[model samples]
Target: MANTTTTTPNAAQDTLVLIGRALIAYLFIPAGIGKLMGFAGTVGYINSVGLPLPEVGAAIAILVELVLGIALLVGFKTRWTAIAMAIFTVAAALFFHKYWSAPDAMKMMQQINFNKNIAIAGGLLALSAFGPGRFSIDKK
Candidate 1:
């Protein structure tokens, strides 16, 4: 018989989970860091949206994005972090993106952002269901 090597499904899944974690974290972490560094800008933008307590909202956003993004990146508390991020993404899409009411000139951009958030939320939900995989802090 000829010798052959085959990769296990679990190994493939583990690599995919790691890649997913890194990609999502890449999307969130820089934005979080930028928000933290430009606190005044984030606060001003939040206030412009007419949401109450812009400072509080900005702080909450910074914490959730940075902390949860890091947790997802390192595969720590995977399911819980993913769930939290998913909820956060949905809320942000509704409250901030609101493409349905945008003016015609900006409507398409806002709609794109809103849809992107929803897509990201779906990915997060999937990550929560599948978890961080074997090469993670939550590994068995």
Candidate 2:
């Protein structure tokens, strides 16, 4: 008699991947919503960084964080979304969380945020390489 097992070894892995995606999305979705709600403030913050075209920067950030974040949460185009998010996270860390140049009073917090962004980016890159697990829309 042949064994008939429907469950794959990847069940746990898929659950973990889904959870990871949700966690990552949780970080960005609210942030994107906050930015959208406070568009003027977001633009002001971008301008404070002396980046050119602050409004454009804010718009792009909103699109990436909100749209791609949703895509990631749902496991849609997971690999590409993860890659884009990784790039965006790194860029944000460099531009907004520049700990090296931060004032002494703010240095520690800035460093923490910068490191967090880098870690998130690393996770995203890993997700991109591994692909979304069996639970993801990409797999289905």
Off by over 4 Å in 2: 1-9
lDDT of every model, 2 decimals: 0.92, 0.94
- The TM-score that candidate 2 achieves is 0.93
lDDT agreement of model 1 with the native: 0.92
lDDT of 1 by residue, 1-140 (tens): 97698655588899999999999999899989999999999999999999999999988898778988999999999999999999999999999998899999989999999999999999999999878988778885
Give the CA lDDT, 0 to 100, for residue 108 in model 1: 97
Give the C-alpha miss distance for residue 99 in model 1, angstroms: 0.9
Q: List per-candidate RMSD values in Å.
A: 5.9, 5.2
* lDDT (10s digit) by residue, model 2, range 1-140: 99887555378888898899999999999999999999999999999999999999999999889999999999999999999999999999999999999999999999999999999999999999887888778888
TM per candidate comes to: 0.92, 0.93
Model 2: lDDT of residue 111: 100
Residue 12 lDDT in candidate 1: 82
Per-residue lDDT for 43 in model 1? 96
> Cα miss at 117, model 2 (Å)?
0.3
Quote the positional error of residue 107 for candidate 1 in Å: 0.4
